[model samples]
Target: MAGTAPSPSGAAAAAESVSDLNYLLRPLHWTAVLRHPSGAGRSPLCFRLYTFAMASFTLSFFCSEVIVLYREGTADLDVFTLTLSVADTDIIWLFRMAHAIVCERAFHKLALQVGRDFAEFVTWDDIPVLRVQCRKVRRFTLTYISFGIGACSCYLVSPVSAEGLPFILALPFDATQPLGFGVTWVYCMITTLHVVVMTMILDSFNVSLIAQLRMQITLLSSKIVSLAKEVSERPENYSETYAQYELRYRLLKCIRHHQTIIKNADLLERSLGAMLLAQSLSIGASACFQMFQIATSENLALAAYDAVTSLQECPLSLKRSLLLLMHRAQRPLRVTAGGFFPLSRESFVSVVNVSYSFFAILRNFKNEEE
Candidate 1:
């Protein structure tokens, strides 16, 4: 399993494991499978349609929202709420488009290798840990999508008769006619579902990849520790030269494992660097706007809720493994925005502080005017 091809049974099991880890991305994978159904099974036509649909609908909505916000110019607290909602929508689509354009091919290649790559780390000892990790991610994704659906459903029904409000808050548009309103409402629902699913899928990809990398680092560390113990306990069996040779041979193996870990991390960054950068900026902007709203408006519940939800969920286990992985590697894998700010817990906290400072300034200006 370490250096040779997996047996037939093993391969089958590995495939199942890969599929389980990829549950979130099943829609995208199925799309690819159906699109071509042969040799790479990546259809240009299908991809174009997916990209076109996401961009056209999301961008059109974003443009409409921006136009309305510009015309209204934050005359009231509702404007901030509308702006916050628009930013959230914009960020989701931004990552979706970036994924389609930048990471599509790389993502497919990585997906294809999942079975083989994962087999290297999964063993009887680590199998339980792997299962627990998978279940955690699965639960998070399910809960995340469930929450989105609930929120969207409430928004859909809150309007008096589904004809009083646009599907999304946007520039004044005609949706007075029953048919027009129905179509707009349906489009918005579809768009929201698509965005939520794609976002979960993308997050799943990163979480799984990082989990695997951490597993490798953990296994490698264990091997190194074991090898050192072996050398210390069994030095009587080996002559000086032979003992040195054995140690060197094992060290080389460990070095190769470490190199593989780095390679995987490099591949991940290459595919997702730009997308992560955009997400970091988008999330930061969303959180900042929500913070501003809470500070300025009497209605605290919605803005506070939005702010809490906008924060990304980082599992404690994954965070620990990541910290360990970075420590073991001696080089942290950073996703940076234009090489200026690295996306990490530190950067996220910095963003919040900066947002709060801006909110303070705005509050002071308002106080002076009052």
Candidate 2:
């Protein structure tokens, strides 16, 4: 629901395209059902089913990970590599948990606000821009899911050797046995799909939040331009008093829009701040390790893929508004990583550069030792 954008006609039907695909904010919808039963309408039953299934898969995955960690210490080179391979999955789990917490807490209010704004303020003119943003989100979601499937398939299908049967993950129990192996494989496959779906939904939600903010900013910019044009024109039929009153009314309306935009941005920060901080740190480390592995080994395309998957693109108009908004706000609307750095593409590239530098240092140290 959040990710869906109006079409060029500003038709409500445009939002329906994403209704069934709305996998991100079930808490917001269902909680409102409990709070206002008469007004809640019929809720989507699939949201509840998906949520429950993912929860079960998440628990199973976590237990399996713990078992693996306990069985094989990272002291071994192979074990360390194996750990790096599943690093993205671990981070996705963190994001999913953070999202669930936010949804259960205050995200419902934000969702309500978003729906209200879309209904009242968004015009057909705004739809095209919003559609572009939604398309970008969809592309990123597909990329993440595709790469996830590819990685899981590779790991699961690898040949078994004399040392032991290679597992999708490290297990304390003997997975070489038929029953044990079958159960582990199935669990890993299901968990892999779970992670893929969550990653797509959660990441799309982030993009949707930013896109909606950008829409408000774009509308505000247009309003400002229109008001300026109106003030510049003097009509021969208008009285000065009537002109002044009209200007005042328009100005007040514009101010209200501006205020609403700021409030929405603030709400977004409250909902996503902690998760962005964690994501920033996780992605930095993931990118570093990925680049390192890519440089040193050939079987690490998955790492490279993970490094690329989290990047989100901003539209050109939205980019301009971001600059304007930053200039207006003394503090700016930045999502910071522990107050050290902002979570953005520039920062992501910087992290990659830092990772490369660290890899160089490690390589030099190894060479010196040799």
Candidate 3:
């Protein structure tokens, strides 16, 4: 009965809400990070070839930089700093690319499952909640993409003004010659832009998944609260048996909804766990960004408890179901990185502190050397 006989307009709204998830991931599909959700079977041959070529180029560029750095040495402070910066960028890019490739299947399945959930669980009344979250996601995606592109443009243009390649690498031909310089510049431009865009898309994809999970948890809490209200307001003419049956039916739906949320959370963790761990270590704010979902999930237990406690008279069987819901909610859904650490505020603070300590040590070492 949930999705049955929806009005044409209502159905359109539901489809729009469902499309948000796919829209957020459209870039990933184009980049071959993950195949299109609508397509079946393995990714097309062209996508595979594109992925291979981009990955090969990235790895080759990284290796070239490292070899050149090693051959020239890093005794000069400027050269040392430049080499470090280049290495950091290339390493992170390679790590992200590798992670995407490894988790491609998991990501593909997770995206499809989430899409189905959106289509089935979203209703006319649920439109407001979905819309709110969708707007936030759209805003975030736009801001992130704009900032990344703007920054990358500046980086690429700076080299042009200075009459140098965007990145320093040892090529076979003399890059200073006009023809060689033109080819080298174009190559750097293409590879650098690809890395920047791919990194942004991957990060956005993960964030969008977290947002979807939080939205589902919010919906579950809303359903539980509504269940209590509806049961309490039952008409006086209704028979006790009928009331009990209705309550049980509605409660069962809520339970199933909770289960779906749990399943999706697990899938998300499996798909991005190791990648998240790497991100948290590399970017101090990554863990902090995930704390919102954790907080929302933890509140679900309290919501369930309050909803059930408000009922004046409840059947023992119904109470048992409510108790089970509370117990399950108390666990507080979490997404962990490689099953090693949960992404939370505490983890964020720890990562920041560790990063700062390393920076301080490096500073001291440099000062001493100077």
Candidate 4:
């Protein structure tokens, strides 16, 4: 059922249809419930941010109606048409918020699960767990900053007349509204903030994920080497030999498990990288295309056309990135808000799970070789 319905008022009926059509075009599409075991608890974690955002968006919707009534009149058709536009904007924002909520759930779940498992993992005391934690911390901090900027940029922009106000601006006021220089100023500021934050987050997360995987590989390799030495040194004594055999067996199993984890980590990294690449290219193309349009020279239209052509190619880039990562993980994920987040940790888990599954399939590639 829809919120808007056709009012009996002859002229108003037309506006209601407009609103309904807008909603129909972009209904919520999250058929995939997050597969996290204990993710219900974490949903509340993102509630504050998203709820505030939704509230703001809803406020904007209401305000736009008020603005319309103020500028125009209570004419049924006019008000109804305005309501339709506001409803359309709200629908888009709602879907976007849903995506953020879903991604946040996954990020929290992967982090918690990984932390729990790592605690139980029996590895050498010399392994750099604390260092790995630090890396993750840096990644998260940077990602939060970057994602904040990127999200705001992609989702909302304030009017030039009200840059000092909240992001929730009244609708274009009228179809003939003209934006002044202030709009560009605000846009520039927001864009600069977005780049700085996204770069910081991506770099931190990438370095941390790689470092954590490398450390895991190092710890497992060391254990395997030590276990091999123990087994080889006492092959003759039955009790000593038996103890050595069990030790070697366990270490070998750990090595195999770790190997799988590493493989999946690699896959996830590529997938995440693909997602970020898509976003960067999209943002860049949007900005550059707009830049090309503002020119008044004879070559301006040509420049704009070239920009549009290049910009059009960006979807192909996004598709390629998604395809590469999807093939690695063997999962068809969308180039969506849920699909590209935390930039690194979440991606690592995705790829790691894939790798772990592969290892399970092989069971004992190393031992079989030996």
Q: lDDT winner among the candidates?
A: 3
Whole-model Cα lDDT of every candidate shown, in order: 0.61, 0.58, 0.72, 0.45
Ranking by TM-score: 3, 1, 2, 4
| lDDT per residue as tens, model 4, 1-370 | 1111233243233222221211111111111212233335455545355455444644455566556556655454433443444444344333433443445443333333234333334332433453455445555655576576666565445442334322323545332234634563454444334233433443343444455456556556666666667666754645866685677667666766585566647554543554455545544554343333322233444544555456555777765654454344433222233755433336657878999999976877766765
lDDT of 4: 0.45
Query: Which residue pairs come into collision in candidate 1?
Result: none
Q: Which is the winner by lDDT between candidate 2 and candidate 4?
A: 2
- Cα displacement (angstroms), candidate 1, residue 292, comes to 2.8
Worst 10 residues of 4 by lDDT: 22-31
TM-score of 3: 0.71
Tens-digit lDDT track of model 1 for 1-370: 1223345446436544733654655655443211211234544776667667666777776776676667667776666566557657665666556565556656655554435555543344444555675577677767876776677677766653235663435535568777777777777676665665556556666676666677668667767777777777884656888788878987887787787678777887897787777777777777666656654433334444454445448666755555554444444344576898976568878999999999999989977974
TM-score of each: 0.66, 0.60, 0.71, 0.39
lDDT of 1 at 151: 73
Query: Which of candidates 1 and 2 is the stronger one according to TM-score?
Result: 1
Q: Comparing 2 and 4 by TM-score, which wins?
A: 2
Q: What number of backbone clashes does candidate 1 have, counting pairs of residues 3 or more apart or in separate chains?
A: 0
